[model samples]
Target: MEKLAGMLKRSREDWAYCARDIMGVKLDSEQEKILLSVQHEKMTSVTSGTARGKDFVTAVSSLCFLYTTPRFKNGDLISNTKVALTAPTDRQVKDIMMPEIARIHRRMVSKGFGFMAGELQSYGIKTGHEEWFLTGFKADEHNHEAWSGFHAVNTMFAVTEASGVAETIYDAIEGNLQGNSRILLVFNFNRTTGYAAKSQSSSRWKKFRLNSMNAPNVLEKKTVIPGQVDYEWVNDKVSTWCTLIQESDFNEGEGDFRWEGSCYRPNDLFRIKVLGLGPKESADTLIPRYWIELANQRWQEFVKEGFPRHDVLRLGVDVAGMGRDSSCFCPRYADFVDTLKMVHSGGKANHTEIAGITKVTLNTHADKYTGKKAMAFVDTIGEGAAIVPILAEQGMTNVYSCKFSEAATDSGGNPLTDLTGQYEFANLRAYLFWAVRDWLDPSKGSKAMLPPDDDLLQEATEARWKFQSNGKIIIEPKDDIKKRLGRSPDRFDALANTFYPSSQEAVAQDLSGVFF
Candidate 1:
């Protein structure tokens, strides 16, 4: 107990020393710098790679901030001091940060630190007298109201996973900053335009960038403390990253292997998540921004006259399934394409409603192109499987079930081939996206038209593509794109399906089907 008191007295002068000697928390060199910066700087922003001990640093810093600040007049404990810890989600606050805080608090109590007294609860820690407390809350746009009423002269407000939190939530947290208070934001810099990214350039903020390669043991090649056993956790992390880089194919020929393999090709997912750098613009996006602008321009010119008549009209329908995503229907004839119409139900749209919409679109186009069988391509995944047969039963026999995961085949049931005469492409999803690229290619003499819709334009420009080892093209999956964009690109999916070849001759027959 005497030794604990002496250490506690010493900690009032040096927080980093206290953490290392008293708390037994080993911080790497980068983490040590960050800890010190948080203590001194008004705002500290840390962008780091995965598994870099960010949580551990945050936990120890909370304790140090509480222990070193001036105490209340009534007792030895720090008074009127509040530490607010928040994240993008409730699960992140309750499951990740709160546990780490509790663990550190328990360790301090076990070491006979008499000055520290707090009940370690699931939500937060409240020291004796309730004057000093560490609280956790979910900070997103929906829950911004919960961040109110925290006003303290000595306060440290910290946010974990700041990249995922919406800008409005960050603004709410910032509004509470008052005299002598500090703010800390830590995240794996994922997106190009978040509050976390914007803060990096602000003169008031001190920023730190760290990655697995710069881990404590990895950089020093030995333990910092004498008699400290080597765990090799840092070494394992570096090895895993190195293997992924070494094994990835660089067939895209423009960016690094990590960028090519990423779902957001040529973007900074690798630089931000693995190298701890700022976000970079995607170089090899599936659909260029200019292409979408040009397509919209072409549509404006084409719409001057009424819908042009053609021998065949194709309709592409993407069902809403459970209605979480909008159901989209796109109809096209030659160079003229109709604007996509998206519908939604409060919940899942009934099959009757899906089939009714599909039938109406098909019948209207079929009447326009009289004596011709207008083909309708319906996505046959999930609820779509039931919608296809319902459309056929409604006398729309020309409807074809387009399974995105199925093997790419021509209209004649022959395997589809790329320009290189080798079967390349993991599935039909890739084939459809490539077809969209070809349709928009000005060099091909195919003047395509599209609606002037910003949502569709954004979706088209953000889609990414990669080439396989055998030189086959692959499109980023919708689920992966949804993670980055927060919603599925349903309109773009329907548009791509419209570009499916109507004749077997459109795709080569001599190439062999090589699945990778």
Candidate 2:
């Protein structure tokens, strides 16, 4: 028994031994690579296909780090040997990782391994000490500060589902890695442009890629050899994927697997979910991804350089009717645009709460940019018309009601025409969207800026446009966009309303003045 205990203690330093011996966990070849990379590299990133044991790898790596590290005399954790885990949501950290850690710890204890008396709590592990033995955090973009102020000698910081975590949170975790600390980032290869995909080119990170086919159970009968057992647990995973692909009519050819039911096409979804590749932009997108990227860059620069205090601010509101869609408000100062608020009322918000919040946003911006005038353009469709009168009651007299079906007019009260002048847009909504396109066009020499919001970017890119038989440009109906996206493009609509050409004088004014 003494010899067995000593051997188990030594195995803590070897993750594979500890997992297989103490916890009775078995890892395949790719999972072994992930564990070894965590031990040997200062930074490791793994992008893998679905059901490739990512969570299992994370749990084993975390336990190995925790059990092997040195402890202090008072039983308090030595700052040098702490383990921190983070995910995009608290539920992931608490429900998923914590349970796995607790299960392994319980198994080890039952097998007579000398793990200290500890109970795994929701977001942490609690031993006899008042302070938590282990901690987990939600790496929200707005809450980067919460991830900071941690330093340790041989720390292990693990980010699960890292592709969904914000870049700012990653930056915060990077700063916290000190001394001989290491970081492990694991996620599905869901996006082509985020930090996870970009990390492959970075020399500092040791990267790993695994696919569903890598699992031993997914192999054909001929692939299995004597003494090497197949992973029967993954048979359902293989069967479901095969069935989904076979049933999909969109499959280009035989042996070509496609998931037709996904929001993205089969090829794109397959690349992201099964083949462990970054997502490729679809060819049919309306707004180019580059435009949104450039806009985000310009917005970041504007924030760093300081918002022009002298610039007049414009506000745009897209109201929700009796629906699940949100009421979105966007405020623009010069080239920079900020979504002031997105209120999800479940179609239950009272008039007073909505009106009060709108009034507060206007007053706050008005106070910030003293001596500058303010204008508001509001969507008057459905329940939105109620807000116009409410704003007027609040002494915001510069508000304009915008009806999508109304005829658009130029400053001279004539029918508004596009740059080509051959034909006008079908309605005011189409005209506003074209104006937004022109404003975002790099060739137009407009450095228009937009917030780094994923929903806004999706709305801007996915909303399509068409030319009417009469030669007028017509944007796709909002209902169609809502059906495809699973939500209304309220953010994009609010932004477009801000660029409505109500008066030529307003457009010509250099709102930035000396501040520019």
Candidate 3:
């Protein structure tokens, strides 16, 4: 009891001490500085390189303040302290921060701090007082109003990976900076001109910069820090990303030249990735912002007038059970797509849940699409494959199981070709994304339309295309995309699956009960 009291009192003022001693987490010099800075500074900004524990420091410090701040009298908090930890999106929060929070909580419980954090809820940590707790939020960068409305005696806001975050989110935070409040900013320092860059440059924040050269592990050429950006990893990145843009020192513009025949920026990739510096721009994105805006404008114009008549009702299911990502459902009528619906699968997504939801959605849209026209294209890779036989047994002939890892083929299972009849489409995933690209290309006179969702738009544009030596065009892998963005592009993957050519096949002839 004496030791507990001492730790709690020190924890109120010194978060680094709280983390190292209380949580048993080993922090390098830079990480310790971030935790200490968060206490005295109103805004502590960290522009960290890859694998530098950007998420870890923020999560630990926030947990430190959240559990130790509240003074309880008969189970009611003396100061209604509220910690709102937000990422660019809800999925990012769930995937990056929440898991870190859970891990820290596990460590705390093991070391005996379960008494402070009463219960771990789906959103975040809960205490005796509902108003006095820490929670993770999903912010629509455009809708700053929804992100507001928490004014407490003690308020803390932590934003992870602020690169492309909407300025409106910062505006919302400005509104709530009252009483004993602080802002914790941790990100990759990815850009030169965004709000994230401003956080690094502005005098309002106490900044800490970390990169490959300074990492203890890289210097010692061993496991100095606990992450992957060690000596061997840095050399690997040099071999892969630093090849085309060679220079005496790792700096900007060295990699502006072409590597092989691809137009990808190898140097800028190294700059933002390894050196922890921002590029002039994210220059290699496949889709343009203007084209997406055109699509959004097109959707609005169509909404002003009633939607045109289209018969087939198509649905795409990106299956994810537990483990950070959510299962998303995207429904469309021929060319016009509807808003996406996603469910948080706290456990494994069994056949019953997905099938029942599919049946329910089909029944709801029964006015226009029925029988052969109502098609549910389910992603049948990994967790999805288990549901295939069960879906077959359910006799939902309209549902087709699609394996994204399979080779790209036409409705007749022949290899795909480009405009000039050359080889194209490295895999089924790439083929679907390319089809989505075509559907969303506003320059093609706006043939198809989808809901104007910011997350959807961000996911669609973030994907870049690369060409293989064999002349096959491929979209960036899902794992790689997940690394850049905090979670799987679940929403966009759901959108892309709806473009499977099996829709035309279903219209032609219903080939039921077989996995594609």
What's every prediction's RMSD, in angstroms?
A: 16.8, 15.5, 18.1
When sorted by lDDT, best at the front, the candidate numbers are 3, 1, 2
User: What stretches of model 1 exceed 4 Å from their correct place?
Assistant: 1-6, 74-79, 114-117, 220-267, 282-516
Q: In model 3, which runs have C-alpha deviations exceeding 4 angstroms?
A: 73-75, 243-266, 280-516
Error of 3 at 29 (Å): 0.6
Best-to-worst TM-score order: 3, 2, 1
TM accuracy, model 1: 0.48
Q: Against the true structure, candidate 3 has what lDDT?
A: 0.73
lDDT tens string, model 2, 176-237?
Answer: 78776778888887775567765643446887777664556556533342223244533433
Candidate 3 residue-wise lDDT, 220-320, digit = tens: 88996575478787767766875543333322222233323433334666767776765543545655544564566667888889876466777898888
Clashing pairs in 2: 80-153
What lDDT would candidate 2 get against the real structure?
A: 0.70
The candidate, 2 or 3, that scores higher on TM-score is 3
Find the candidate with the highest TM-score and give its number: 3
Clashing pairs in 3: none
Best model per lDDT: 3
